[model samples]
Target: MWKVVVESKNQEQIRHLVFVDGINGRIRLHFDMVETSLRRKVYDNYNNPALGLPGYGPVRVEGGAATGVRDVDLAYEYMGDFYYFFKNNFNRDSYDGRGAELVATVRYCESYDDCPYDNDFWSSTKRQIVLGDGTVTDDCVGHELGHAVTDYTAGLCYFMQSGAINESYSDIWGEFIDLTNGKGNDSSSYRWYLFEDDKYGASRNMANPNIFEQPQRMTDYYYYCGIGDNGGVHINSGVGNKAAYLITDGGYFNGYSVRGLGLTKAAQIYYETLTHLLVSGSDYLDLYHALYQACMNLIGRFGITQNDCENVRYATLATEMNRTSTYCVYPKAPICDVGEPVDIFYDDVEGKEYWKLTPVTMLVLPKYLYSSEYARSGKYSLYGENLDVLSDFAISMKKGVSLPVGSALYFHFEHAYDFESEGSTMYDGGIVEYSIDGGRTWYDAGPMIINNGYDGVIYTGAGNPLSGRYAYTGTSFGFTSSRLNISSLAGRNVKFRFRIGNDEAYADDGWYIDNVRIYMCQVKIVDLTGYWVSVKQTCGRTSRCTIKGKFVVQNTGTSNSSAFKIRFYLSNDTIFSSDDLFLKEYSIKSLKSNTSKAISFNVKLTSGLNAAMRHVIAVVDADNVVNETNENNNLLPSVPFL
Candidate 1:
């Protein structure tokens, strides 16, 4: 019924064959030995050398059989794509910078019960990739390998903001490879979508993440903050994804306009960020700085211009990566009361405080010893024990306090400690630190301390964790007032903490703190006194008149006044009210105390009011953003048109 024929020059060089069927007629096959041998040689030399292990196969050829498997072929193809991309773009050898072989297992299942697993992941423990059956698209393969690259480079911690950044880097690389791979779809509508070629359609759109319930910007309402998915790593990654997309395809988003840099330039910026400018604990804010630094570094290389750097900045701004606070969390400082010194933050330690204690190590001893036994002005005080051996611990304010602008602030506290000490050498001690990034990192406050400075340095040879650092040690006899001038940290959200480190030997009665307060000594009140308003008019041939005036505003407060706004109104009387016809608004920069600024404005008379009877009134600080000492004096006397 069927007949088979083969024609060959040798065992290695098959030429042609014919399959004959009784009813279906003859089917001829032609094989090109040169092309097949060349493809096999190329795969053997390039792709096979990059793989750490043999791929799944049905033995179609010696090395070509592995490439015959669909999923295995996709994995090897994209891995080679990523390799060439980074090698040619950034001069990177491989994911590890050492030309290490990439390891991947396709059709990976956790167990026989869970066969045909539905996902792919980069095994952090194994340092390899495990591909599932249902999600092995090109971008997915590239995404998993991208994780390997991140592991070898930034090594960003997989939690919270850092975790989100990790996920976003993978997505960015995956999408980039997908767009430039010269296979599948690379159109505008499909380029920004991850997993577009998968059987289930696209899973995410980097240009507009809100289409898949992800936050395109940091302050979006859909930002996830839950504990699952490693603190919303997958959800919040959309912020960085949107940033990458905007950087590559320029758009207006979140009040910022970015000019698109092509894929190579954008990829260079991100590669520099991931490889050079980031750390394990870096967050979105750090990512912004890293991107900026990367752009600056690449200004002259590869034809990168200043405009590219500015577009990078605009992209970060559009994604709100410059925000220092947590995603979707807006912290507003309390408005300062008028006519009194503003207490920016106060904690008497009498039970209404939100202080959190964290131990630096795995010691079982209780470090925080908050008790009612010691107090400077209250019934309670925060205490930390010096009994823990070779221990470092800290108690920090859970919520950050925003320092208002235009004022000098002070950190005031009363504390006493009985630290272990030898003759002129301290073994146990405590120090004050402040964090500008919501307690993610802390810096020493010793440079800012003005009164009652650090007693001495902790002995370096005593095995104390905070050895060689200046701290409060020895007996203070009783509670002593400590003052620090923290005016440099104004206009920033900051958190404070007290850290104590002890050596392995002696124990003492510990440290006690009470009556902590951050206050401004002199209230920076902005008394906007409008001195005068001089008006003139220009009449056109159409009977329309343009009125122009120069209004002088004086800052009569004890301290400098910040930037404020001025509004012009046309009224029947000299008094300014809400019912008056608003004309125009002007912005005024900061003015020192006892200084004056003259601002000019022009308004065309459009309404049918009697020109001779109308009076122009000027009001300063119209938005009330500035705290003023004399709010009623902001209105200038109405002047008649000359």
Candidate 2:
């Protein structure tokens, strides 16, 4: 064919040049070699069609109808095929990515300052590579060129575990494609692309890393000076590289060396994981899950996990981290959500908020309302005095707009405040009674319920006046009777009233109060028909619950609870009880931030004592639990649920 020329150097040095024609410009793909530096071999599919993979693209000629060293500003002409590919694909100046008249001439550059990498390296602008002659190859082309692909196709692969992840990923594809297309060199190992030299050669140990760490030192980010090819992405990817290597070889990190198939298998697995499954920079967990799922997809779960695959890919991820997983655990879902008619109706009352309002009893949403960690997001009010009246009173719900199901509701007595108090001490027979029956009936919340003697000051007594922000006095108080035990009366609408004084000299200082808090808790109970399970739940203690059959451990009474754990054990084991079916040994759980169980576990008691009786005994702490303490802070060891 004749020669097509764009900008030619009329140096009488060389003749017979390969010319590539363009729309407005003509260029020559010079094959400068008297010795002909081209390899002639029968390549299957991976060989470059025009010239072999670039070992060296150009050389200086002295003189000839074919050779003479002329100051030809351009580098060795690229492959006519490659030149055609470029001219056909990227021939545009301002054009995005259509036709390929990309640049007038292809030359070589050594430093980045002279090149415009920053300008269009990642931008959707130009697609050209002026590689140093030493940096040419179909594999290398696809690898480095692949960066432009991702930079063009997807956004910059930013989350590089290392600057090389992109390189690594694309390397896999490039290597495979070259091999697949007969363009790959025999020495090109995906893990070792040793032909090019390992960058993080240390981390590339594949057998061991704690060495060859100069370029691969992922602990820092500067080893790659300005080689912003992968955007310095391959830097932090040793871990992942090793992961890939190990993956190909069955990921058997026995001691150091890897063992298994090779790059082909590894490439297949990783490509599947990355392209279809993984979101780039996915965590190890996600990786493992993806790998597992992908493998299952390719060759059925049973096939992979069973004898079908010899290696039995068990995912070294979790093992590498030394982690243990419990049974199938789902992410905690939103417990509650905002629903229609966000009010609890009493005894089917029609639209009436409060059926019976109490007097001596004050109604104020606890001013000291605690924003529980779980309830801070929304307006989650456990119990608001004015809740029945004010819509502002809210409950924190996992479902943000919804409410938690079977969630215990509770309020904090956080210090105290006067809600409508007068403070007279004659005892106008003021009583604080509670009713579970939709406010229809009222029962004494506790014995501390004062009558014809005490004054109107709850949590307000002797040596202590309410502290700094406290409303009044009595830092503490005890109930002579069950103060407000609604455990036995769960699912019951409740109300409290006062009869302090009708205008008499008895009940003066109206009252000090805090709104009640509601908590919803679900207990997992195992039925001990004739046998038992172990309860390991303790103040961080391991306990077990053994049972004969399946029995439901429902939230017995009220869902709300306060102070430490309030539970009972029903094991077929021996009882620590001294009285009628009571566990002498207390089974308690420690609580973290909330008053809820710190660590709720279970214990196995025995039916040997009363097997036929099915005695489920109560266990309480020495301190104030569901048990009522007298006004003197005296322990009232009564059952939690009155």
Best by lDDT: 1
Please, what are the lDDT tens digits per residue for candidate 2 over residues 116-207? 11111212243444333233344444444445544432222343222344545545444443444443344434434422321222123332
What local distance difference test score does each model get? 0.75, 0.31
The number of the candidate with the highest TM-score is 1
Q: List the residue pairs that clash in candidate 1.
A: none
Span of ten consecutive residues with least summed lDDT in model 2: 474-483
Q: Mind giving the per-residue lDDT tens digits that candidate 1 earns over 1-642?
A: 454545455332344445555686756443443222111111121222233323333222224545556666766666677777776676566677676566667666665565556677887676567776646676887788798888888777576677889999999999888888897778777879999886668989999999999999887877886556866889999999999999999999989999999888999999999888876546787789889899999998877898899999999998988874453322222223333456878888888466878775435345455855555433567887887478888878889999988777888887767789867889999999999998888999999987777888999997898899999986654345678888899999999988889998888778878778898766455687876657777776666778777878888876788788888888878987789988888887787888888878777788444446568887888888888777888788556765
- TM-score, candidate number 2: 0.33
C-alpha lDDT (0 to 100) for residue 581 of candidate 2: 41
RMSD, each candidate, Å? 18.6, 25.9
